[model samples]
Target chain A: MQRTTMDLWVGLFVVMGVIALMILSLKVGNLNVYNPSQSYVISGNFENIGGLKVRAPVKSAGVVVGRVTDIQFSTQTYDAVVTMSMDSRFLFPKDTFASILTSGLLGEQYIGLAAGGDEAMLKDGDKIMKTNSAMVLEELIGRFLFNKASEDDSL
Target chain B: MLLPRRLVSGIQHIGHRVIEGVWRLGVASRFFILVLLKSGTSLRRFNLVIRELYFTGVLSLIIIVVSGLFVGMVLGLQGYETLQKYGSESAVGTLVALSLVRELGPVVAALLFASRAGSAITAEIGLMKATEQLAAMGMMAVDPIARVVAPRFWSGVISMPFLAAIFSVMGVFGGYLVTVVFIGVDEGSYWSQMQSAVDFRFDIMNGFIKSCYFGVAVTAIAVFEGYDAPPTAEGVSGATTRTVVTSSLVILGLDFILTAFMFRGVS
Candidate 1:
């Protein structure tokens, strides 16, 4: 009886542990967000990909469909190259537009996709020809000031 | 001349202490390997490990749960206050979950385990040694390490990650209770935002790995201190104190090194 009681307690302990791990993975962490079972990679080139980072969400109409996998600079063209892993379930047309967008006034950045009415769909390893760069806060402010100065001159 | 002589002796004393520390570390490493080698017996018997698990893991559950909930609640309260200033109180769930999984869960749980269970293991073994129980087993041609120490060591190694996981889960729930129920944070964003922020492979797996290492380190230190304690009452007491102190310092140092490697700009 003593031995049986000990075994029962140990069994209970192990069960609790398994349950805790399940809770951590499912409820607390994003274990179910990006299923990698069927995903394809496509690269995009931008003139100035400001403040964009790898693993940033790739969203379509506010729904996340992929993740930014890699970011590199192309020395030859002086443009930033971003490789994205897109879910196979959501295919984009060849002329899809990829733009870097910030969530809030000062929050994380993500890639937004807008599909064009192209007959051809983008395949794995295909390059996204049309790309929009992230908006640099400093550059935006500088341009605003310059426009204000130009308006004053015109006045 | 006198001051110069004193300085020279002080330097010598420091050097001596360093060498002694290195030598003790070597001894501990050897003991750790021996315990590992003898662990087959514990695995084969199985019941031995279960008993130790009850003592070390089950007994520590109440404290781990209570502390985890309080820690999570505290994180929620403080995180809300800070994020509320920026009108981003919804991010409190993200903060609580990330901190608990990435650092506090494994680190704090290990610290508590080291104090509660680690000290008990050391005290038990030290008393057995003081009473010559180990020696009595040796007279019967039994390997005391394989019979006595290996079970405790394996039990600790197996139990640590579970305790840490439970702690982190409880902490997240505590945060939810405070932020969602009491503080009136939006329920949907509180969970959805956290889920988006925390990655299972990166945050959860890394935290699990950290707890496993802590378990090995804490248990190894506990058993080593107990086995090496001079067979006397004062000696046993001193060894118990040393086990807690050394385990704590090692846990913190290992945490820094692990964090530097694991979390360096991953986000």
Candidate 2:
């Protein structure tokens, strides 16, 4: 009887460990098991993706509403096409703006969504018309330097 | 002239000891293979393994959880201070979670397990040998290695992954307590940032796999030392010390190899 009781406790302990691992995988590792199959997919095209990778968070109004599911380069358009899976709970307008954004000045990049004032909501497989590519600091700095040089030359 | 002679003898002694150490490693590996083979018949010996697991694993829970909490808090506090300077204080959660999950989780837990359970295993087995209990079992036509040593060895292997998971999870909570509750950082960023940064396959799975390997190496060393020790009080105590010291070193060494294999492939 005592042995059986001890076995029960050990079993319970193992169960708790398994549950904690599950939480770690889902909450910490972003496995996204709760994202239902009914979620919608939307594509946005960008000239540059920066450091964005698959499984990046898609946030709307500072709340995570979905995830970046896939990223592919369109050969014909010569642009990076990003596919996002948005949860069914949230709906955005057909003209929603998709922007590549970073958490901080130098942190992981994610997709940020801003809803537009359109009456028609986005449906499955819809394309977001307005897209913002990742802002490259190097390109901005280079442009600033070039503008300063050109102005000095004109003077 | 005298100094040269002494130096020559010292070099010779060192060379001899290195060869002996290599031979001892070979012997230990052979013993491990034999024990693994014996464990094939260990189904009937599972009750014994469970009892040891209760002692070695369940009893070590307090120390593992407490240490995990403190480690996480320290990481959180340090991470917050460092990231605050760069205006990325919200990344504290990611910093703490990544550090704990990637490196410290398996390594620290295994170190503690070596000291707590690994030493206990060696001492227990050594004492049994010293008291001639193993010899008595042998006289009764029972295989002591199969019934006794194999169960303890396998139990340690089975328990390590669970211990490491608990350590990481508790550590995560400890970090949350500090960053979100105590420091007043935005709670959502703490969790969401960590979720997006740490990957399930590469970071978390590799950490657990490292623990399992450490588990096998540490327990094999512990049980082998116990069974190899001389049948005396001094021998039992010495074996216990060797188990703790040697297994700790092996765990650290294996961590480097495992980390290289687990991470170097990712570009």
Model 1: how far residue B126 lies from native, Å: 1.1
Give the whole-model CA lDDT for all candidates, comma-separated.
0.94, 0.87
Candidate 1, residues B1-267, lDDT tens digits: the string is 366988999999999999999999999999999999988998998889999999999999999999999999999999999999989899899999999999999999999999999999999999999999999999999999999999999999999999999999999999999999998999999999899888887799999999999999999999999999999999999999999999999999999999998887676
In the range A49-83, model 1's lDDT, one tens digit per residue, is 77888788899998889989899999999899999
Total clashing residue pairs per candidate?
0, 0
User: Where does the lowest 10-residue lDDT sum fall in candidate 2 chain A?
Assistant: A29-38
TM-score of candidate 1 against the unseen true structure: 0.96
Model 2: per-residue Cα lDDT over A1-155, one tens digit each: 34687797677777867986887788787667335466988889999999898877798887888878889999999999999988898999988999999876777788999999999999889999899999899999999999999999999
* Local accuracy of candidate 2 as per-residue lDDT tens digits, B1-267: 356888999999999999999998898989999998898667575787787788778888899999999999889999999999999998888888888888899999999999999999899889999999999999999998898899899889988888888899889999999989999999998997788678777788989899899899889999999998889999999989999999999999999999898877342
Best by lDDT: 1
DockQ, in order, for the candidates?
0.84, 0.42
Each candidate: chain B TM-score: 0.96, 0.95
